[model samples]
Target: MAFFGFKDIDKLSEVDMAIYRYIVDHDEQVPLMRVRDMAKGAHVSNSSVMRFIHKIGYNSFPEFKVSFKNENQDLMRSQQNILNIFTRDAFPHDIEKTIKLVAHLMLDADNIVFFGMGGSGAIAEYGARQAASLGFNSFAVKDPFYPLIAQLQNTSNNVIITLSVSGKTSEIVETLNNFVNSPDTILISVTGNIESPVARIGRYALTYNVPETRIHKYYDLTSQVPCVYIVDGLLMELHNQDIERQK
Candidate 1:
């Protein structure tokens, strides 16, 4: 197979070659698996896998895998390639799966509550706003303690959507520890790390593997843009679901 999308397969470094070979070997698999697994198979690190994907013209490992499998070949091939323009395009990553997951959760939910701190908190608010516009009952609680306590009461069977990219924010971590066991509430975590504590606590977790938009790396709030995009996409699906339900 073509390594790194070019004829110069031998030009790649050992790390890149390992990742490339792994992708080619597993390109036929269905449902697309994680880069972590592939890296493990190659006995390489996750960062090395990501670098390999980037070297191969993909923005992220997820994008690379999506193209590699060609399982949804028509949809994958037909769509326009999305390129990130640094500050202009903000969320250059495609978070469609995360949105779809949230939509499905909302479809069966009685209520929805959002939790986050700092920029993730803003994302929580954005999600609440979008859900509200769709006539869904929702709240974005920036103050952590009340929401945690509310979950314990079990008065409403709401879905608690926690926005924590790293999945280790103090507020989110504490909230999960306090509320994860609630019988009436379902925990939905939108985070970058699928293996983090928040994801572990969540009833459903939508994991984003974008290392490029490291929100915590800088002082700016741009990292939260991905969360906003995800919330918006979820709202679109929720609107569709509502229309279907009404019809």
Candidate 2:
């Protein structure tokens, strides 16, 4: 059978219960505390501590401490994320101008293309569906290797919306740069970095100004909450403008 689960209170003996209680109550201290200290604090012997360590499936104290520290970091990061994200002031100072510009572009565009990757890719899909629901010819291209959707014609009446937390994705920057200088084909990028390549190339860039976050070297765990807010704001602006025209 597998070792006693953290929640297996019934399976935990009295000594195990003592160890579990001390660890939970002193979580922040346990990672840094010595094994003998843990035993002393838990009111158990050192051998009891070893038994509890194996009961929880860790072969050694250092191994258990590493796992505990990672969990602690995750907990702290999650708490910080919740406490710090999404306030009215977190939006761009010139959001009014950006929204109006996006609205104007959508009204004149033949089609809307949204571009992004990973977490931002999901946001691109959402933006396309939302814009389409508002009566725009909208589609999302998440694949970095997608074939040319259409020729890069000046005044082609096309608009592309890009979502990138860093605004540094090479495929998006290279593809959009070819069309940014042309008239009637607008590029609107939503990013956290104003100076990033994609943002620099955009006709209009809306930024959230949040710090980038990554849980690992290759994976970006940055908050996309601001991107969602900006896209919704833009689509709503277009929707309201369309309503005004009808009346």
Candidate 3:
């Protein structure tokens, strides 16, 4: 895939390849170019430009241009050494599956608990609030004792959503291990590291590809945008599903 997750040019026909190459080479200008103008520049017909745009997964030229501009804007904003830009884009890749799974879990659970520590704790709180707004029984719990109490009170029909950017937080890992044997409890972990211990313990894992920086470990420069994106997306899906059911 090219930048912004566009299909590889090599997969296109000869004519479409030329048009795609023109777009890539003149990305800054293509977003503003009319179909006829782009066709003329690429030595193709206007219909061919439309076909290429649709072939690239957009409904129309305007849609394609909007996505192109948004991707470029993200790049421009991240030029100042922000790693979160890349992480932000990662959310959309597996969004459909993640949202579906999370929404189902939320609907099925009697109670939903959000767990995290430090920076992740804030994200957990925000996620819980978002879920609550969608009418789910959700709350963020930072104190380990609270989770233990909740687990003891209601072991079955409960869903736990945990956030750990590193996916290796000892406290999270231990907490997960405490409930690993509970077949009725569903654990969902959101993390940048899919293979880390915390992710492994979860029943479902939502992962974002963020480069781990040592600076992030000490100073907390890592972007929580991906975590927030996943939480928001999941809540939106749940809301949409509820609307559909009502209709």
Candidate 4:
């Protein structure tokens, strides 16, 4: 996947993230947006917007706009490829089955805990927030040092969804290990590697099989677009249940 200049989105501040999300949500309109326009939309100053542009690896707004325009024009989102970047087959043949299974766990659970660290950690928060918006009692945990998970021990009605690119994040693997034998604890792992330790620990696993994208020896910037895709699928699956009930 072509990175957008920065190492990753990890270092982005809340203000930067606001701009980033605004740009993403308004992607088609971005090329035409002026700096002041972005500032207004993200509720930030014009200077803040400029800082975010550079922070993401662009020299200037015009440069970022050119690249963003080209990316939108060239990249096609499909099962075989995501954003024209990942080369591997990104979805399983039984994706519908996987979606249903995840939805089922969420529907049956009293609480859903989303866990990850770093980029995946942000995704964990997104998953939790999204799920809660759908009226599920969902919680997000990104801090490995947080000790509250002990409350989940041996609980059958709790679902722990772990997001990772490599699936070997020590914090995630360690947390999963802590619940290895609890019959009531359901584990669902979303990762780029299906055979990773986190996947092996899950009762259900969804792997995107995208080639790893790493940099600086420590950052796994693997396209998490797949993780977001899986989470969206699960949300839609549960949404379908709502649709069915209205019938």
Per-candidate TM vs. native? 0.56, 0.66, 0.62, 0.64
Ranking the candidates on TM-score from highest down gives 2, 4, 3, 1
Q: Count clashes in each candidate, considering only residues at least 3 apart in sequence or on different chains.
A: 0, 0, 0, 1
lDDT of 3: 0.80
Could you tell me how far off, in angstroms, the CA of residue 184 lies in candidate 4 after the best superposition? Answer: 2.3
Model 2 stretches astray by more than 4 angstroms:
1-83, 149-155
Question: Evaluated with TM-score, which candidate comes out highest?
Answer: 2
Model 2, residue 13: distance off in Å is 25
Model 4 C-alpha lDDT per residue in residues 133-161, reported as the tens digit of each score: 98888989999878845767545688899
lDDT of 2 by residue, 195-226 (tens): 89988887788888776777768789788888
Q: Any residue pairs clashing in model 2, and if so which?
A: none
Q: Tell me model 2's lDDT, rounded to 2 decimals.
A: 0.83
Candidate 3 lDDT for residue 235:
81
As a whole number from 0 to 100, the lDDT of residue 33 in candidate 2 is: 91
Worst 10-residue stretch by lDDT in candidate 3?
Answer: 83-92
